[model samples]
Target chain A: MSENKTVLYSYWRSSCSWRVRVALAYKKIKYEYKAIHLLKDGGQQKTEEYSKINPMKAIPTLEIDGHIIGQSLAILEYLEETHPENPLMPNGAYERAIARQMMQIIGSDIQPLQNLKILGLVGQYSGDEAKKAEWARTIITNGFNGLEKLLEKHSGKFCVGDSVSFADLCLPAQVYNANRFNVDMTPYPNITRVNQYLLTIPEFIEALPQNQPDAEPQC
Target chain B: MSENKTVLYSYWRSSCSWRVRVALAYKKIKYEYKAIHLLKDGGQQKTEEYSKINPMKAIPTLEIDGHIIGQSLAILEYLEETHPENPLMPNGAYERAIARQMMQIIGSDIQPLQNLKILGLVGQYSGDEAKKAEWARTIITNGFNGLEKLLEKHSGKFCVGDSVSFADLCLPAQVYNANRFNVDMTPYPNITRVNQYLLTIPEFIEALPQNQPDAEPQC
Candidate 1:
């Protein structure tokens, strides 16, 4: 399980993929980035080759120690556990749960609702771009509403207390997606403040979608 | 921080709530079950009082030690950590990650897509019962396809190993959901085998939605 031999199957715009990227950067773990272009050629992720690597047909599958793993949260937990040098979670059990609570709010609640396939399904059903965007906005707004309240109780410089935890790893990515969908951030002052602070962190900045090798230029 | 004094805000049919219910039973943690009727009066989860307990307006909110926590996975992690007597996660980093991988596959991938709000959105857009069911079946099939592959490599008596782990905690609830959506389980032999085995377990059987105090007989 050598860190140097790691290879990450990632796509630039994938918020889930962005999560593992940030964690790897924060831990200063070197790995090969195999860009799986999600939009090109009807999604490279859907290719038979990539499917063998990740049966879920999702982005951000990490390969380490001859073992391939999927699910961004699972991969993040693995990294945190195996490489405990720069911790991404808080120390205590209760505090760690709080961190995970925030992560799940974004990861499970918000991101899944606005995922590429889901949005596509929305568009297919409604045949309206506005409706699809509205769907994304509604889920994001609901999730952010809860996140704002959580941050009020748990934030200092990050999503949970003074340290940068797993919650912080998920926040910026989801917030970035929220902006992409034009979900108003002004309603979430605490979330906005923490996201603003997170953007200044070197690890967070390095893992931004724009900073990735496969980032497409905004037209 | 006493286990006996806990209160779980749950809904009978909610798969997420079922995850926690089974965990509580497995750990022998005595807790009060506060049924929040999700469908009654336009969802009690959306009520102002319930929102105070969980700002996300979601279920399986566990209250203990003056702290209210939402997100089923986080709650399960908390129970595993705070009460390590009946451990849900296996020992060691790699093994734990595998447990989490299975949990996330079901928790994030399958369950969220088939959640009540998502199906509601599908119905609202398409106005087709078949489309709604198809949407659910599609996601469940995709998730189960991956899960079956995972189980083949990582199953013994449960989803991860010989002993029940966090992965097992997530499986039965998700399998029950898959059954509810009419997803054919025959194709995934591994998932069916595990799900069948899980149904025989006391904890899983006790946490079945039909066994809950708030259970309503099928019309």
Candidate 2:
């Protein structure tokens, strides 16, 4: 496995890509970064060459040890299984299910409703920038509201428990997204507290969108 | 584990819930079903009592062995982990990643955008029932398009390979969703093939929404 090269196809600000970046850094797995600009030249991810490796034409596709895997949560599961050192999953099955449940709170509910393509469609459908922003804000705020309630029973130093799990991988990136959309974070103290603490971790810090090679100067 | 009593909080028409039903049937796990009608009395899932058990107020929340698991994909993973009798996951790590990848295509990308809440919002905003239908159709079509392409390299007798995996659990329910929105399935031959084959299986037939106790007579 050491002889195999790991290559990640990523975009700078894609939250899904950020999740994978954090996991790779946490597990101390070395991978070559291949930037796939989501908005450049009508989106490089949509090109035939990139689509060959990732049929979904989405970022954070990992080509590791000759297997090309799309979907960020799936990538997180793969990394946890392959590199158990500095484990991102909790010890037991129930705990691991909780981790997956928390991550899906963002992955399935929040982020999917506010991704670039969906936002673009919203803007196009409404023909109003304010409406688009409102759409994203509402989606994020609603999702975080539910997340805050769930975290009441599960929160410790991190999302599922004291130690960082794959659930933590989704938090900071989503908070960043919430900030981008001007979501009021005051209501979600649990998410805010966990996200703020996560931002200080080196793995998450290095994986921040602003630190990516393709990050814009303003970002 | 045999002493455990499993319970599922579900709505008959939820595509996500239907996925769990198929998996439970395939694995031969016995569970008590408690119906949570999504549209009756302004959606029972939104009630304060239900919210305590499932903060997100979404159906297909699995209560098994004293742990309450939310999120459909997480429930599927928990089922596969707990009931290894008839395995729903593949053998190798790469194959399992492929299984998760395929499910995420539907779970994260497709279904999230077209759920009852989103469609209700679309109908409310646009003030057009047809527009809401269009929204669901477009999302499902785009997702199925990508899924169809990915299935090109992965399909044998099932979504990931010859054997049934978690990926197969998502197919029939989604195909049902697509038809409800009147999506033309002719373009997705791979998906059409796999879905039709899956329909003939006994577990899937028994898990059909029409077979559920709470199924609407029209459905």
Instruction: List TM-scores for all candidates, in order.
Output: 0.96, 0.97
- lDDT of every model, 2 decimals: 0.87, 0.88
**Residue-wise lDDT of candidate 1 within B1-219, one digit each (tens)?**
354478998888888999999999988987888999988899999999888888898998998866778999999988888888977788877778888888998888889988888899888888786788889998899999988888888898788878888888888878777877898888899888888899999999999999999999975
A128-182 per-residue lDDT for model 2 (tens digits): 6567788888889888888898787888989878889888999988998898888
Tens digit per residue, CA lDDT, model 1, A123-212: 888878678889999889988999899888889998889998999999888988888889888889999999999999899999998998
- The two-chain DockQ for each candidate, comma-separated, is 0.78, 0.73
Best by DockQ: 1
Stretches of candidate 2 exceeding 4 Å from the true structure:
A1-3, B1-3
Shift of residue B145 alpha carbon in model 2, Å: 1.2
